[model samples]
Target: MQRQHSFDQTELGTLYLVPTPIGNLQDMTFRAVDTLKKVDLIAAEDTRNTQKLLNHFEVETKQISFHEHNTAQRIPQLVEKLLNGDSIAQVSDAGMPSISDPGKELVAACIEHDIPVVPLPGANAGLTALIASGLEPQPFYFYGFLGRKPSFQKQELTALANHQETLIFYESPHRIAKTLVNMIEIFGPQREAVLARELTKKHEEFLRGTLVELQEWATVDNVRGEFVMMVAGNDVEEVDESLVDLSPIEEVVHLIEAGESTNNAIKRVAKRRQINRQDLYKEFHEI
Candidate 1:
């Protein structure tokens, strides 16, 4: 039997996942600029937005729109270009492509066709905020964007309230106020939280404190720009050692059988009972 290697840049089409500036144009990496200049074509989530970036860089790479609306139709043509020896770079409006932004479908398609996909890491609002947030970075979850409706947002927050890992989410200026209020209600007013706005821009600000304090500050007028919210996880409540030893596994299974998700069940039992979900998870898997 013979072994086959994956697509190479010289043999197959190269798909570059290029990250753009989150706010400040200067944040664009030197390598990213070089990649854009060298690629045969650029696929942008928003051509207009990307045009401004290209203009700033003076990199004459041609760009075409490849966002959620047109990704399905655009995949074939992009793959064809790659097959024809053209290297294409994918860029979202801001930050990295496919980081809860766009570009997953194209990347998946490229993988199926054995195309060479290379990612050039750069500015990421979520990670940038998380680092500045002073929150635990390792055990954190990224909830890209919350639902706009109050009800949906509330349900989502409530479901995640008891999460043991730090939570990160993105929000627009228009809805930041409402989102903060919902956070206070669901995650408790005292939960540690951080909100970073206008990252890398002149008005960039990192607001840190309890949910209540953040909400209070956000109420002021003109508090606006791209925002990344980092929230502290629920503290384990002390359990009465005398209580019946209801194994966390049993509780998880019970709740799941009653229609709760593994996630929901874990959070519910873990927060209310002060049990480590991971410990129970290990036991469950071992058995």
Candidate 2:
């Protein structure tokens, strides 16, 4: 089926959002190469990182750095180039761009300026993990990157725990173990989950079990490489808000009166509420 949009007469340069491999170079799509080769410029999250892939496929396209740190500054420059009739392509470090990654601002700006943006279907770690996860896919949520800083991370985890859809999260190799422990605490020890690591790579492993079991396994083994976490939807029995043993506000007051520091108390309450600690702290103190 042909796309409804008319591409033949549109003057605005086409912006191709290409998805590269999460792992395994052979996963690169043929159309992605053709698009990269045809575009005037390629906006890469990392030039050095993208160079390896470019060399392998022998794509001679010029690449410029466009990432989270510099996307604000780069958007206008890229827009200007696009306005000048230069077709541009955006690729992330891996998977697709604007997927818990930069490229959103650039895409939005292009759309605002009436630039034509085209998305090329390709590999994505979130969907890759989801399909193989054995979890219900239609009703699901993708929460990417539970980075360091335990307080905020736990808050995000807790919110997802209350969600009815299957939850997927991206976690770093170093933090996966700690994150799994946090998952066990927030979602319960019995939540069935899958941890996919080094997907499509030589040592790829998909560890599936309850949160407690996975935590124990990760603790003993040497875990290295990126991870895609798939956790089953919360059991209806688990989400009865009335069953919450303690109201967050009430818990906050109790902890404060028990001599817990304000910061500690707020962190505890926010986790229970599944809200951001900073937001909770401000509301609690009316800051």
Candidate 3:
């Protein structure tokens, strides 16, 4: 229950989450540029990439590397600087800072320490693709990136199979074909979907069709660039109980096949069936 007045004067400096352009440089907002220039320090996901954006905008702010690899080490230092009244702006390689990006940890630290976090609205690939997807826009779910592992990804898709809202997913070019294949298996071939690529760039294109058509296109055409895949929601209700027929060990095996850890799968099965956890664990391990 914390309230933040972004512009209010305080001893601690405000952390500004600035969004950069996803593709075209023109999409970089004026406020984002200004905040980048005005902040005492810039925590960037990639300093070299950010330097290019800074050069384009004629902004000469000093930047420090603050990516996924360095988050554990950087968060404390950044928070300390904020406490010392040095305003900081956090930016990712593209789009919003914390949307499937690296700024959320820093944002959490700032909030925990009573520092202000000011966010600037700017380009986002998910929403950018959603509006033009020719699907239901209002009740859409944004699922940024799917798990790389086949089983984990299948599990995730299986979990979302019954969602009535439209679903959004980010996928790399190399894996689009495989992802679509998995989606077809879980969401069916007839589900309407749109694949947006090279968003806001000169070669941007949108392919709208059913899951099977998209898979065919992926197989036949040259699939390049990052993709934003918007899938139409499930219209027909599916039977929710997928694990009802399986024995306790078989249920655990199913979850394990879907990439869940064995111990966790056993615990989940035990809790759901109101069985003794120790007995399930012993039985699972054949002990």
**C-alpha lDDT values of all predictions:** 0.86, 0.85, 0.91
Across 105-126, the per-residue lDDT of candidate 1 in tens digits comes to 9988888877778889899999
**Where does candidate 3 clash, by residue pair?**
none
Superior by TM-score: candidate 1 or candidate 3 = 3
| Candidate 1 TM-score over all chains jointly | 0.80
- TM-score for each of the candidates: 0.80, 0.80, 0.82
In candidate 1, how many Å is residue 146 off? 0.9
lDDT of 2: 0.85
Q: Write the per-residue lDDT of candidate 3 for residues 228-249, one digit (tens) a residue.
A: 9999987753323987788989
Which candidate comes out best when scored by lDDT?
3
Where model 1 places Cα greater than 4 Å from the true spot, the runs are 1-10, 241-287
Q: How much is the lDDT of residue 284 in candidate 2? A: 80
Error of 1 at 55 (Å): 1.7
For candidate 1, give the lDDT of residue 255. 76
Candidates sorted by TM-score, best first: 3, 2, 1
